[model samples]
Target: MVQAQDASEEAGTEASGGDEAAEDAQAMMTDESAIDDQAAREFFTSGSNLYSLGRYHDAALQFQQAYDLSERPALLYNIYLAHRDASEHAEAAVALRLYLEATPDADNHAALTVRLENLERGLAEQEASRVSAATAAEEAVRQEQAERERREAEERALAEDDKNIIPWIIAASGGAVMAVGVVTGIIALGLASSLDENCEPAVDGVRFCPSDPSLELENKQSALSTFAVMTDIFLIGGGVIAAVGLTWGLVRLGGAEDDEDAPTVSAMCGPTGCGASMRMGF
Candidate 1:
């Protein structure tokens, strides 16, 4: 009988221990719930303050935190409100759906449903406009690039044509001047022949013969000297100009062996006559 009584006392002690454990668990849960409620209240207060300050994005974040802390449908509605006010229709729609799911029987279900539909429609339109704008901008850039390339090609072509024509023009001008010189030299030679014939026997004889004294012969000799000097000037100048043009043309045509060297022209006009020389380098 005493052993039976001791067994009953052990059972009684076990029961008392179980009750204390249950009490401790309940207290822990209450503390956790209180902490969560305090966190939710703080988040909600911050969210409201942000909303009042017109900081919708920050307000949305704060509201999202409050929902995370307490999982309250009302907090989600506040998040939706913040997102809508911020013009973030996509996020607002998502928040609205969550609110509807959490509280299907909420009194404002009809109003929220209408709001969500409007947000969805706005989201669709915004997405369409963004896509259209992107396409137009890309096309504009492509056209601008094409126009720029065409302009550049045309300018290059014109420049290349100028480069090709300049040398030809110089060469033609030089040839014309040289022709003039040749013609003038022939006339001067004829005049010299007449002067010599008048002086004496005109076979390679240019010395003044005292045997024939005439003022007309002296004047003809003076004219011959002037013509000879003029002829030399034209010939030398023309030859230098022609050489410059030909050298430039050959260099441009990539036909010159030593294109690195540049040709130079020099002129001399002494008491005797005018003459020109070309220092052909390379």
Candidate 2:
């Protein structure tokens, strides 16, 4: 009977120990949960104080820390509200997106959807602004290219006209005039030649020729012949001078004509007009 009483006592002690251990574990778990809840409450209280002080960015940070600790959708939504109040639209959008992901079927689904739509609209506005800027830049480049092409075409056309048409006309006209003057001078030279042949001849066989009376007459005739030869020489020289003068005049006139006919481009680039005129060889 004493052994049976001792065995019952041992079993009762084991049962009491087991129940105390279970209660201790339960109390530990409760204490840990209370510590976590206190930490979360502290964070939420700090965040609410910052929000009341109008320090939305600081409030958002505090709320984000509370959400990290508690994993509460309400805490995340408070973070989003603080971010929005701070005018940090991007941060607000991110925070809201996180909240929506956490609680898709929460009570405020319509409000979250409206916030996402506004964020999307802001993103769309940013995209449109970028596109407009790019299009304006492209249009400016195209306009500059077109203007350059137009100026180049105008310069090329002016150069071609100067090279091909006007120079040819001036050269041909000058050449024709020079040829006519040369032919007329040659005819005059032939007439002078015939006159010289008829007027001056010396007879070597006759002692006294009555037709050509004296040496004085012969001297006069020789002087006249020399004068005629000098006149012919002067005429030939004058004709050559005239022909050269004509060619020079033609070249100068052609230059003037080119200046007049070509389109004048104004330039502010220093002296010599910045090569606006064509350099055609005369």
Candidate 3:
């Protein structure tokens, strides 16, 4: 009987030891759960602070972390709210769908489902608008490029036309010189008429002046001779220059018509003299 009582005491000690071990394990699990809850609370507070500061995307990330730690359907709703405020419709829809799936018996399930459909439709419209804007921008760039090319082509053609401008300038200069000659001739004729009216008839082409001959009559005769010489010089020189310019222009025009790659000729006239230049390309 004494040995039996000793065995019972030994069994009682083992059972008490097992109870202590089980209690310790329960305490450890409780501590771990408290740590997790504290971490989740910190994340939830950070998310709330970010949302209040209008940092919606950052808030969404914080709330997602909270939801991961807590596995709470309510935290998913907070994530959806953050994503929605940030205009992340797709992400908001995903979060809301996850919340609905996690909590099938939610009171607002029907309303939330309708809202998801609307969000999806709006997302589709947004995508379509973005594509249309991109296409319009591409078309605009294409039109601008084509317009630039056309303007460049016209400028090139104008540059080619400018190559023939020297001939016209020479011709105009010659015409102006000829006009001056005609006016000088007219003045010479007027002076001669005045001289004839004042001078008397003479023998051997020597005019006989009055005994008291006026100095004005002699000056008039001198002026008439000078003007006549000037008229002849101007008319002849101007005619030659004009003819040269016109002939050069005709030759260039003919050459251009015959061959696009023909030799080119250019003429110029100035106060000193007139000149011709030629260029040949092979």
Candidate 4:
């Protein structure tokens, strides 16, 4: 700090003089130039040492610093050499182009041009390799997406089949029960009607049932009572089964398709026979 203050005082005294101050200023400028040259030399030596130690990128930076201090186009070519040794072909190409721009009339222009062409070719090959790798990655992603969609579609199809199976089974069971009930009921009615003339009402509508008290008549009446009770039981049971099946089917279908139409049921009863029917609107 003391030396810097003394130097400033000396510069102020020199400036106070006339020709002597101007001469001193010129000498200072000369000394600054020499210092810059010495600093540039130090940077250049450091860069050479680093390069010999196989630090090509560091060598390139050191050469760049030297070129900045000296403004020498030859140093730009040295930067290109360091970058080339580091396998940075694109950077080497850029440095060579800048060197050509800085020293347009250099004697080695043809040689630099050949080297630049080689570096540019290597850069182009690297770009093509990257593009090919990117395209392959994109194709792999597309195939993976397609496979995922296909699996999802298959799963959805299986789910739909599962949803429909319950309704199908219920409908088939209801149909079978209804058919069996109707056939058995008709046979029971026929057997009961066969005794209509023989069996008559006694007191308070109690049946005499075969019109006389003979053993054969009593047996016929018992058979008639049994068949009548069985007819009612089977028909009522079958009706309950069919109703349960239909209700369950409708409920399941409604859950499956909330936006779709529902099924309709119709029934008719007569003296000879009774039956029901169903229809789906959608």
Candidate 5:
């Protein structure tokens, strides 16, 4: 009988222990539920405050967090409202669609569907307008580049023409000098022939007898000597100048295009004589 009583007491103790464990588990669940509710309330309050401050995108994020914890269809509607006010049409449309799916029997289902369609259309137009603006900007850049290249080509051509003309000008100047020399030599020859016809030779070879007594033979002889000296001077100078000019011109024409310095030739005539000068630059 003592053993039987001891077993009954043991059974009572075990039953009491099981009851306490069940109560403890229930208390733990209640605490966790309270914590979740507090968190959800905080997120919801934050979302509402952000919305009032005109931070629609931030408000939408907070509302999404609250809905994640609570799984409330009403919170999804708040997210749609926030996204729509922020002009985030695509996000707003998605939120609205989710809300409608979650709450199929919502009172404004038809109106929300129509609003979603409008948002999608606006999104399409915005994308098309952006593509067109990009295309126009690219075309403007291409045209500007083409214009710049054309201007550069024209400038290069003008420079080349100027370079080519320099050689021709030098050569022409040399030809003109040679022609002047030839004319001067011809005048000297004419003066000599005239003297020969008007003066008679003497035995000493240094004296002359004038055919005309009043011809001023002394002055005529002095003029002839002057003309003879001038003719020799001009002919030698002119030939040297012409040769130099032609050679220089050929060199210039065949030289490298990048050479910046050019040689120059000049001619001068004075009462004493005529001569040519050349200058070169590094």
Candidate 6:
């Protein structure tokens, strides 16, 4: 009975020694992990100092190496700073968003808040300025189009006015020519009547020349002269009608032109050279 009790006690002591050895191993691993974390932190601080002094590339390398060993949120924030100093805005924004997500409560909360607000405000202002510029460009395009249309319309109106004037001028000239031709015909007819009367035979039934030709031609001459005068009067009346018709047609065509094209607004600048132009069209 005494030997059995002694063997059981020895077995219990061995189990306790084994348990202590396992605990000591775990403690050593914990200490090693803490030391590694401290080293990483020191490397990150050194990189941050370099970045502040404008050594961005070196800082990025250090932060990158530290991150490879341990993916800590604070180290990611340092990586963001290095990227920002190097003018890598896209990469910096990406890293910063990730870091903020990991640790929303960093040590420098007030400074972080101010920086975030400033970045947001700057981005918003830039967007607003871009929108305003776009709107201005659109307005300029619209104004140019309107001006082109107005100029085109003015040319059309001028062409139409010229068209109206040309027909009137042609008609008036044609009427004047017709009047001259009719007057000439009347003069020719009168001359022909005078010649025919002067050369007529005295005895009409026998068709023989009279002894006194002057007495024989007097009546025939008078009748031919009367016919010539009548022709001249009719030609004069036709000429007058043609002239009136031409004038009336031209006046009516002129009235039919667009009213909006009558008035124009124009702008000029400088002493000798002109600047921008502005015009209005109905």
In TM-score terms, which candidate is top?
Answer: 1
Task: Kindly list the per-residue Cα lDDT of model 6 for residues 84-121, writing each as its tens digit.
Answer: 78876556666676777787776765676566566656
Model 1, 1-282: lDDT tens digits are 000011111112233655988766766777777777777778788888899999999989988887797777778888988998998888989999998888889888888799788878888998999999999999999999999999999999898879666767777788888888898899889888887676665444354744435567777777787778878887888877887888777777774544345467788877677877766655
Candidate 5, residues 12-41: lDDT per residue as tens digits?
Answer: 223365598876676677677667666777
Which 10-residue span in candidate 4 carries the lowest summed lDDT? Answer: 1-10
User: What lDDT score is found at residue 55 in candidate 6?
Assistant: 94
> TM-score of every model?
0.67, 0.41, 0.55, 0.60, 0.58, 0.46
Of models 2 and 5, which has the larger TM-score? 5
C-alpha lDDT of all candidate models, in order: 0.77, 0.62, 0.74, 0.70, 0.73, 0.59
lDDT of 4 by residue, 166-252 (tens): 555756676676566677667756655655566764454246663454666666556655655555544654565566556656666
Comparing 4 and 6 on lDDT, the stronger one = 4
lDDT of 5 at 169: 71
* Runs of candidate 6 exceeding 4 Å displacement: 1-72, 86-94, 186-190, 193-198, 201-282
Scored by lDDT, the top model is 1
User: Per lDDT, what order, best first?
Assistant: 1, 3, 5, 4, 2, 6
Count of backbone collisions in candidate 2: 0
Model 6 TM-score relative to the real fold: 0.46
- Regions of candidate 4 where Cα sits further than 4 Å from its true position: 1-33, 175-256, 259-282
Residue 277, model 5: Cα distance from true site in angstroms? 16
Where model 3 places Cα greater than 4 Å from the true spot, the runs are 1-36, 45-59, 71-74, 97-114, 141-166, 186-221, 244-282
Which sections of candidate 2 miss by over 4 Å? 1-91, 105-107, 166-173, 176-282
| Better-scoring candidate (lDDT), 1 or 6 | 1
